[model samples]
Target: MIRFLTYPLVILFLILTAVQVPQVFTNALASWQIYTPLIGGVLGYFVLSIIPFVSRNREHMITFSHEMTHWVFSLLFFRKLYSFQVESDNTGSITHSGGRIGEMFISLSPYCVPLFTVILLLVRHMVSRDYLVGFDVALGVTLGFHIGCFINYTGLYQSDIRNVGIFRSLVFIIGFWLFFAILILLSLKSDMYVACKGIFLRYWDTLVSFWQFVKGLL
Candidate 1:
C-alpha cells in the first residue's frame, strides 16, 4: 500500500530533479576552484582503476561500503543490525529487522547514498581553508569511486532492486543522485544551511509549477 503511494512521489521527485538540472550544472561548472579538484579526483580514480592491484582491492571497499550503507540506514530507522558479512567475491550481506519503509531505504540506499562522500562532508569543516582543494579532490575521488562501483554493482538482477521493483528503484536512485549532486554543488558555493535552503527553494518552485500544470490539465 505504501509502495503504491510512493510511486507518484518518486516520479514527481524525478521530475523536480530534472527541472533543476540547468541550475545544478551551472553551479557545478561555475567554479574552477571546486570543479578542478573534483575532476582531478575523478581522473585519479580512472588511473587507479587501470592498476591490477588497486582494481582488485577495490572490491573490499565496494562490498564494505554497500553493506555498511544498509547497516547505517538500518540504524537510522532504529532497526537491529544482525550479522554483516562481505565475501571474497565482491559480494556482501547485511541482516536487519525493520519496518517496510525502513527496509526499502536500507536495501536501496547504497545505490544512491555515496557513503564516503557523506563522511567527508561531515568532517569537511575540520580542514583548514588552504587545504580545501585537497578535500575537494578527495571528495571527487570518492565520488568517482562511488560512480564507478555503482555501475559495476547495481543491476536489474540484484536483489535490492528486484525486491523494491526495478522501475521504482531506478527512479529513486536517479532522483537522489540529482538531488545529491545539487547539494554537493551548493555546498561548494555556500554552507550547509544555505545549500539546503537552495535545494528547498528549487524543489518548492518546481513543485508549484508542476501543480499549476496539473491543475490546468484538470
Candidate 2:
C-alpha cells in the first residue's frame, strides 16, 4: 500500500523534470525569445537525474526538514527505526517492520513540505528582479531538494522505483510544464518582478505560517 503511493509520487517528480525536453530545444532554437533560464532549469534537473552520484554526496538542508516529518511521526507512533540506506540511484528509505500510518506519513512528507519549499523559492525568485541570483538560487534549491531526496532517501540506486509512478508522474510533468509556461508567458508581456510580487503577496500568509512552524521546530 505504501509502495503504491510512494512509487507514484517519485515517478511524478521525475516526469515533471524530464518532460521539458522539447520546450528546452524549441526555446534554444528561437534565440530571439529565448527561455534560457527555463532551459537551464530543465537541463539542470536532467543532469541531476542522470548523474546520481553528484547528488548523493551533497548536503541538502531541505531533506533534513522532509525527513524530520518521517522521523517525528515514527517516534510519535513508537515505531522502531530499523536502518537508513542511501542508494546509488539517489533515493533513501527507512525500513521498519510495521506501522501503516507511520509509513504513509513518511512516504507523503516530501509532497507537503519539500514541494511547498520549492514553490516558495521559485516565487521569491520571480519577484526579486535580481535575475541571476534569483534564477541560480531557485534552480539550485529546487534541483538540490529533488536530487537530495533521490540520493538520500528513495533508494533509487538498487530499485527501479526512483520515479514515483505513471499517474503522479503525469501530474508532475503537467505541473512543471504549466509552471514554466506561465513564467515564460509572464516574462513576455510583463515584468516578472511585478508578477512574482503579486503571487508572493497572495501567498505571503501561508508562507509565513510555514516558516514560523519550521522556526518553532528549530
Candidate 3:
C-alpha cells in the first residue's frame, strides 16, 4: 500500500531534482576549488576505465561496495544480515531479514548511494586544508569508481531493480543519485549543512513556483 503510493512522489522528486542540475553546474563551475576536483574525478573515472588490469582488480571492490551498501541500510532498518557473498564474476548478494518497506531502501540503495564516495567525503573533514587538493583528487577517484561501476553494472534486468518494481527503482535511483551528486558538488563550496540548506531552499522555492503555476493553469 505505502510502497505503491510512493511511486508518484518519487517521480516528482526526480523531476524537481532534474530541474536543478543546471544551477548546480553553474555554481560548481564558478569556483576553481569546486571544478578542479570535478575535473579530477572525471579524469579518475577515465583512468579506471582505460586500465584493464586495474579495472578487473577493482571489480571485487565494486561488488563489495554494493553489498555493503545493502548491509548498511538493512542495519539502519534493524534487519539482520544472514549472509553476504561476492563472487568471482563481479556479482554479489546479501541475504537479510526484511520488511516490505525496508526492502525498497535496502534493495535499491546501492544504485543510488555510493558508499565509497561517502566514506571519502567523511574523510575529507579530517584532513588539513593544506592537502585538500590532493585529498579531493582521491575523493574524485572514489566517486569516479562509483560512477563507473554504476554505469557498467546497473540494468533493467538487475534483481534489485526487479524486486522493487522497475519504474519505482529507476525513479529512486536516478533521483537520489542526482540529489547526492548535487549535494556532493555543493559540499565543495561549503560544509554539508550549508549545502543541504541551499539545495532544500531551492527545492522549496521550486515547489512553491510549481504550485503557483498549477494554480494559474486553472
The most accurate candidate by lDDT is 1
**Over the stretch 37-64, how does candidate 2's per-residue lDDT look in tens digits?**
5446546665665566754554443444
Cα lDDT of model 3 by residue, 1-218, tens digit: 88878888889889889999988878777875655865787687777667888866787888898899999999999998899999999878889885866778888888888787677766566788898888778778877887877898789999889978988998899999999889888877765667778888988999999899999999
Score residue 22 of candidate 3 by CA lDDT.
89
Q: Rate the local accuracy (lDDT) of all candidates.
A: 0.84, 0.50, 0.83
Tens-digit lDDT track for model 1 on 14-109? 888878889678756676566788789889988988899997798898889898998999999999878999998877898877686666778889
Candidate 1 Cα misplacement greater than 4 A, ranges = 212-218
Model 1 worst lDDT run, 10 consecutive residues: 184-193
Candidate 1 vs candidate 2: the TM-score winner is 1
TM-score of each: 0.91, 0.33, 0.88
**What's the lDDT of the predicted structure labeled candidate 3?**
0.83
